[model samples]
Structures are given as C-alpha cells and as structure tokens.
Target: MNVRTEIIAGITTFLTMAYILAVNPNIMGDIGMDKGAIFTTTAIISMFSTLIMALYARLPFALAPGMGLNAFFAYTVCTKMGYDWSFALTAVLIEGVAFIILTETNLRDAIVNAIPASIRNAIGPGIGLYIAFIGLKNGGVIASSSATFVTLGTITSGPGLLSIIGLVLTGTLLILNVRGALLLGILGTTLIGLPMGLTTFGGVAGLPPSIAPIAFKFDFTHVFTVDMLIVVLTFLFIDMFDTIGTLVGVSTKAGMLRNGQVPHLKRAFMADAVGTTIGSMMGSSAIATYVESASGVAQGGRSGLTAFTTAVCFAVALIFAPLFLSIPGSATCPVLVIVGLFMLSPIRDIDLDDYSESLPAFICLVLMPLTYSISDGILIGIISYVVLNLLGGKRRKLTPTMYVLVVLFILKYVFIG
Candidate 1:
C-alpha cells in the first residue's frame, strides 16, 4: 500500500535477519574455522540469495545461510570429523545440484508430502525457538551460569541492558505500528546502550584482517570419500528442508500459495540449491531461505519487494565489514530476541486440540531448545507423529515413506547415540 510502510518492512526484515551474518561466522570461529572469510562470504551469498528470491522467484522471502546447518558445517565437518573445508564444500555443491534435480524431477514435492501432518506442525515454533536460542547465545544474554541454568546480567553488560531496552522499545514500537519496528528496536537498543559504553563502535584500530577472498583450491580430488560425502549430503538436505519449511510458511502467510501449496516451488527450490552451491564454493555454508522474513511479513509486506530490499541492504553492508565487525554482541542480541518474540506470535493459531498435532509440535518445539539440535527436533516430531497415528487407531496413515523415515530415524538415533 504505502511506500513508507514498504521501506520500513524491508529494513526491519534486514535487521532481524542480520544477526545470522555475524553470529554464523563467530560460531565457526569457535571451532578454529575461518571466521573472516566465512563472514565475508556469507554476506555476499545473502546478497545473491535475496536477489534471486526477489527478482527470480519473485517472493517476498529473503534467503541466506541458515544457522543450524552452519554449526554442523563447522563442528561436524571441520572439527569432529576432521574433514577439510574444501571437501565439505564439494559435498555442499553436490547436494545443491542434487536438490535442483530433485526439484526439477518433482521429487521435492514427494518429500514434502511424505512428512506426517504432526511433524509438519512442529516446524513453525520449533524454528522460532531455535532462532531465539541462537540469538541469546550470540548476544551473550544467556551464558552458561551453572550446569542446568542461565544467569541474567544485572542491567550492566551490553547484552543485558540492550535486551531490556530492546524489549521495551521494540514492543512499544510494534504497538505503535511504527515502520521498521524490528530494525528500530535494534537501532534504539544500540543507541540507548551507546552512552553506557555497552554498544561501543570499535574504531578501525587494528589493521583489517586479510586473506584471499575465496581461497579453496579447486581440488575436489577427494570428492568421493565415503565419510565426507555422507556428511555433506546430509547437511545439504538439512539446509534444503529448513529452507523449504520457511518458504512454505512465509508463502502461506503472504497468500502466495496455490491450493495450499507453493506454485513456483521449483523456482524457489532452485534458488536455494544454487545459493548453497555458490556459498560453499565461496567457502561458506548452506545458504537457504530465512524465516527472519517473517519480520518483514509481520510489518505488512506481502510482495517480493521485501526480499529485493533485504538483498540490496546486504550488498550495501559488504563495503563496511570493518564497521559491522565492530558491533557489540549485546547490540545484536536485542534485535534477535525481539524478532524471536515476533516470530512466536503465530503459535496462537496452532490447533493444539488434536493430540496428533499437539504431540509432535510439543516434541519438536521443546526438543529444539532442550536437545540443542534442529534435526533432532524434526526427528522427534517425526517419530511422535508415527507413534501417535498408530496408537490413535490410524495405522493406515503410515505410508511407505513414513516406514522408511521411521527406520532411518531409529537407526540414526541408535548410531548417533
């Protein structure tokens, strides 16, 4: 409708999602991975992902490297498994290409249909809580205080005070229907935290770290290694499903779904697959559609315009890596917490009356935070879906695909455990 409202929608979407760009790299850094290049490459892919979603797919949703998969890429691939980033990148590329083929062959649709209803229900709030958890972890608001609990800072540290101010300001702005409430919430918190020295903008003191922008030697000589192929392919599908779930949700909200299904699903799938391929080639992780665009949808955006705006913002942000690199973790935490709060609003519509729906959803939602794994949440939800269906005297619900998933889930849980 109004041009001003549209601009605010776009900007808010960017801010809510921007935390991923910074946090993903930091998480990688903890595992002794390449933080500098990872962040830089991530930002660049986000720019491309957004453009494709907006201009090509023509969806209001923005795409980027998803968080859950990034942790897997860094920790599982590089650290625990002892695989080089190059070989992992090769797996990412293979998965991306395979994803494209699946979409083209209409196999992606089959996969989506194969998921049980209850498991599908779990994805929404599961991702919301997951996003919030990552936000808290990155913002330093919820640090490990004890074995089983977290201690809050006393309104002093950057994250504590900013989160407090952000909650208030973002909440108030949302109430006021302020354009870009999410972005303003973050900016407002940053401003409030500034005088307190919590949101200090570290001036360019240290010489900016330098390395080749894209440094993986095209040596896919070990692309066929069994272990590397397995991990990479797994991550590829992980990213793909997460992205698809987010897109379906956002599209439904935008009323872009035809017959309750995405019409141009193939195009959207291709964009995600291609984005992931390019990301790894550039030495980043699996790029996928972001649920953070829900922040944009919440602000009244319903067109691809928001995605285009987010892409443009990311592209513009690349020139100022030195500046973005300096933002205090607390400053970003408030934005993330508020966005999580916004994302959680959809939980009200869920029909918890049906145990079939309620059981899997509860499992998936809680497992996300408790087990600290996205895939784990999905697995629990899937298992519960099958269990609930069978026990509820609906054994006919278990398709061949469901049986396969059940066997796979059981084997995975046993082996991984």
Candidate 2:
C-alpha cells in the first residue's frame, strides 16, 4: 500500500472506532467511577496498546478495552457481584499475566488448535452480531421491554431516525466503493444531527482529565476467593478467544494468514497480553484486538504503519475530547453496524453440511447476539460441540483440550457463576 493510502486508512480506522472513548466512560461511570478518569485511561491505554501492536507485532490491528468485557467489569463484577472496582482491576491484572505465560508456552497454540474448525469459523460472525446488537441498543433503535425482553424504539425519535438514515447512507457509500466511506458516514451523520437538534458541539478542544483517581488503585484483598477466580478465568478466556478470533478474521481478510495461522503470531499474542496487563494498572478493562481494525485492512492498510497512524490519531483525540464526545450514537453506531458486515465475511468458511458442525455453529451465532455475550456464546458452543460429537459416535474427533474445556465450562456455571 502507498504511504498516503496507509495513513488515510489509519485515520479511517480511528474515526470508526473513536466512539469508544465516549461510550466507555458513560458505561463505567454508572457504577460511581470517575468518568473523567475513565476517559483519559481509555485514550491513553488505547494509544499505548496500538503503539505496541505497531512497533512490536507489525500488525494493523488496534487494541482497546473490549465492549462486552467492559460491561462485565462494570455491571457484573462490580455492581451485581458487589465487589469494588479495585478487585475488578486485580482480576484483570491476573488474567493478563496468565495470558503472557500462556503465550510463552505451547498451551496457547494448543488451545487455538484444539477448537474445532466449525466453531473457529463461527466466532467471527458471532462477534459481528454481538457488536451489531450493541450498536442497535446504543442508538436507541432497540430497548428493554417489560413483556418481551426487547422491543423496537420510536422510529420517529430524533436519535432513532438519525441512526436509520446514517445506516442507510453509510451502507450506500460502502456499496459504491467510496474511499473513507466509514469516516465520511460518521461525520456526515453528526452534521445532519446538528440541524435536527439531536446533537450539540461540546466545543472544539480541551485538556484531558487526570488519571490520578483510578491509577494503580488495585486491591489485593479477597483476590483469591472463588468468586474472584471465576472472574479472572472469565477474563482470561474471553480475552484469549477474542484476540485469536480477531487475528484470524482480520488477517484472513487482509491475506496476512499463512497456512491457516497469522504470521509473527508470537509477537501478536504478546502485544495483546502486554497491553491488557498494562491497561489494568492504568484503570481500564481487558484490552484486546478490535474487530473494527478490519475496516482499515479493508481500506488497503497492509502493515504496521496503519496502526502507527491510528495510535497518533488517538493521541490527537486526547486534546479534542469535545469533538469526539460531540458525535452522537446516531453517527457512530452506523460504523459498528457496517464493520459487522466486514466481519461476517468469514461465515462462508464454516462446514454447513455436517449437522454436528453446523448445529453447533448455528447455536453459537444465534446466542452471541441474543445473549449479548461473546464468552457465553463460546462456552455454549464448545459444550454443545463436544456433546453432539460424542452422541454421534464421533468420540475420536474430540481433542483432549476440547473435553477439558467442556468440563471446565460446566464447572464454572455450576459452582462459580
């Protein structure tokens, strides 16, 4: 790719994913954490992690606090489980250290290879649906209902209507093969919403908040409890699968996967592990490779230079927090919906003819969006795959690791969860 093209691709990736800077703070803020501190932590960790990916891994993927993982950290771990934020951060730190150890040994590769090809093929599309559901909820196109669990929102509402228009316009631009289509769609939608009285400019620039309130506030008390162990294991499993899934899905599209594996795989894993470990100390959730990076790869970003550009954009974002925060869900949600389309391309790799394979994959796909949890979808898929194969008298087809994972998942739900 030309240097100019790569730089543009980087900018495009940042634009498509920048909504996280605002969204994360709001989500975490619900539980009494300082929103300003979370915002600064989000930007700084994202910048550091992306820079690591660029310089060490030489991949185009961007790293940030993952969507579902953050929800679990805030709502489940802290609010529902009634644990403090420090304990949550400690869980993340432990998970990250375990990932580093796994990366240095054969266990990581073994776990990767142990997943059946059918389930492996399903995860990308599953995540696509999960994220798309997030977009729909975030944009207020869908909402919780007392009777039905979920119901359609008022389409005539300001944000809902704007999101619909944005999705259509963005989809059209992508179909026309427009350069920077995702970025353009985001800005255009925001502009349209300004006149509709649905969005306000929070000024152009401002200094970022200090990270002192949450920085290095980890608590080691009760870190060894059964509940904390369950939390840590959940983090470890989700981060591992999510990172591997993104590597496979994005690299496959970019033609960076050789012989069914990523080139420079060790460094890629290390980048994620190191990022997660550091991000915990910096008061963020588990950092992982973003599936949204596929947007950059789709734009002809072929090397680390693309990631470097994205990292720089994040640094610039710190100064212009208002501009980014000014973008409403109507604008940014379209990018998530569109990026989901890019990720779904790998569904063709699934073996659809075999019932054992196809059934498990189908359940995995449906559960992700329906349950709104990637880890839950993965756990069910693995258990279903093993049980289905065993009942089909295909016992020899199951890997030892697959059996172990099934047992562990069952135990987790039975006792810990």
Candidate 3:
C-alpha cells in the first residue's frame, strides 16, 4: 500500500465521520451527562477502537459511537424509560458481551439472516426520519403544537433561519460531491451562527477534558429488569446489523470481499464488540464500524494503514475538545437532517406491491418519527409483519425467531408498558 495514499484516505474517512464528535456529546448531554467528559470519552474510544480494527481486522474501516444507537440510549432508554445514563451504559455493556459471544459462536450470521429483509431494510429509513425530526426540532424548524400536536416553527430568523442556510449550503456541497460535506457543513453553520448568538467561541486547542465524571459509571442494579432486557436486545440488534452492513458494504466497494464473503469478518465484528464493551467503561455509547469508511475505501484505501491513520486523527482530535463541544445544536442539526436523507436510500429496495411486506415496512418507517422511538418501531414492525403475513396466508415468510420476538414484544406492551 502507498503510505501517503493510505494517510489521505484515512483523513478522508475521519472527516466524513468526525461530526459524531459534536453530535454524540449533544445527545448524551441532554440527559445530564457531562459534555466535556463525553467529548473526551468519545475521542478516546474512537481512537482506540479504530486502532484495534486496523491491527486485528486488517481493514480500512473506522469505529465510533453510532448515531441512532446514541439517540436510543439518550431518548428511548434514559428519557422515556425513566432510567439514567448509567443504566443505559450497563445495557450497552451487556450487549457488547453478548455480541462477543455471538461472534465467537458464529451465530451472528444466523441472527442476521433470521430477521426479515423488509423489516431490516425499513430500520435505516425509520431511524433516518427519527433523526431528521430531532434535527428539525433542535433547529427550531419544527415545534410542539397544542392544536395538532406538531407544527412548523418560525424560520425567518434565529436557529431556524441558520439551519435553513446551513441546509442549503451543505446540500450544495453534497451535490458537488464534497468529501467532508457533513463536517464542513457543521463548521460553516457554526460560523454563521456566531452573528446570530447561536454559536459560542471557545479556544480551538487545549488539554482534553477528564473522562472521570462519566467513566465506569455503569449501574448494574437494574440488570435483571425487563426493561433492561429490552434495552440490551435493542442495542445488540442495531449494532449487530449495522456493523455487518458497514463491513459488507465498504468491503464490497473496496473489492475486499472474497466470493461474497468479507475476509476477516469475525475479527471486524470482534473489534466492534470489544470497542463497545470498553467504550461503556469509558462512558460512551455503543461503538460500531462506520458506513462512512466507504469514503476512505472509495479514496483507494486498501489496507489497515488507512484505518490506523484515521485512528491517529481521532487521537489528535482529543486536544480540540473545546472547539468541538462549543458547536451549537443548530450548527449540527443540518448534518443530522442530511444524514437522515442518506439513510433513506435503502427504502428503494422495499417492494411496495406486496402489502404483507410493504405495510409492515411502512409502519416501521412512519412510527419511528411519530413515536420518537427506534426500538418501538422495530418491535411493532416485526409484530405487524408476522401478524399480517400469518393472516395473509404467507406463513412461509415467517421465521422461528420472528415468532419468539413477536411474543416478547406483545408481553412487553401488555405487562411492562
């Protein structure tokens, strides 16, 4: 591998995903986690985990706290479930351990195949809508309403106006095929927010914040609770599929797949699993392989050196905590909206003519944004898929795992909910 090409590819991948530095802290901070500590933890976890991926998996992929998973940790588990961040962290830890076991036993693929393709495909778009809704709300583009339960916010000025401008600029950059469109969009929007008093200026470089406040703060008291089971399962479900999808997709783009199988796939999964397990101890969300690594692969990254370079970049980013933490919600909101758009691309694969599949997929997609919960969307979608298929005389489409999941989901709604 060419060293310089690998370095450039690594940087390209890091730029595409670096927005997580700003976005994760914002999401977790809302639930009373220390943003400064989270910033440090995020960087540390990303750096080390990606380094592990490079050394062990020998792949040009990066790892970090995932987007939708973080949202679920903060909003669904902590905010709605009335659990604290520690409880969510414990759940993540458990999920990581379970992931490790599944990977070792070679059960990961079986579980992945067990989930219906329609439901699996619906998840990304559902989360996209949910994330976009959050962005709109954060930027003041959408507001809670008394009459209709939701309405448009004032867009002529303030955060809403800034978000609109950022959206246009970022959209333009994306249209032009900019490599770091998301990160550049965040920075550009933050600069625009300076005059509107939405962005605050902090020093660009400094010692990284201490992670002591949030690190190793997991709560195990509720580990046996039903809610904890649901939370852990949800974390595993999302992380498992997302990591697999990223590894396959990026490897395909890089021509690293050998006869439809990803070489070193087990090692890649282990890297993600180990990172997530340790990242919880560092007080971060579930870490996974990033789909954005496709950017680096597209840049001709063919070896672990590219991932190593990206890890080095994350390590360097630790010193810029203040700058990243100072980015206002409005500035990062546009990226979320754009990412939401990116996530929706999978919807094209859903066959709309078959109501047995399409109706459940539609339910899964719509309920995520409307209910503001990813787990609920997945659970209910599975339930609907199973029931509709059973009723429609399409019983062959149902898997044994689907039946078990549908039963558990029904029990959750009937008793716990």
Residues 1-417 of candidate 2: C-alpha lDDT, one tens digit per residue: 599988978887887677678667766776778877888899999999999999998888898898667866876678667889999999999989989999998588675678787887787688777767777777878889999999998668678899898899888987897666776787788889998998888877899878899889899998768677768866876687778878877898788888888987788889889999999998899998888798888888988899999999989889866666677877867876775676676689887888999999888878877876666677789899999999999999898888988998898789876
Stretches of model 2 off by over 4 angstroms after superposition = 1-9, 12-16, 26-33, 71-87, 219-222, 225-230, 245-261, 291-303
- Please give the RMSD to the true structure for each candidate, in Å: 4.4, 3.2, 1.0
As for TM-score, the candidate ahead, 2 or 3, is 3
At residue 385, candidate 2 shows an lDDT of: 97
Question: Which lDDT tens digits does candidate 1 get at residues 1-417?
Answer: 656666677878887777665566666665655666766787788989788877778767788887657755655566556666666667777777777788789787676678765555456566657667766766666666676666654565556666666667777887897655655565566667668777656543333334365445344787765554456545754666677768777777777778888866778888888887777777777887878787788888766687788888887766656545555556556555655565454466557898776777788778866666655677677888888888899888688888777777777667754
Model 3 over residues 112-219: C-alpha lDDT tens digits? 887788888899899889999988898889899999998999889998899898998888888999989999998898888998998888979999999999999989
Clashes of each: 0, 0, 0
What are the Cα lDDT values of the candidates?
0.69, 0.82, 0.91
Better of 2 and 3 by lDDT: 3
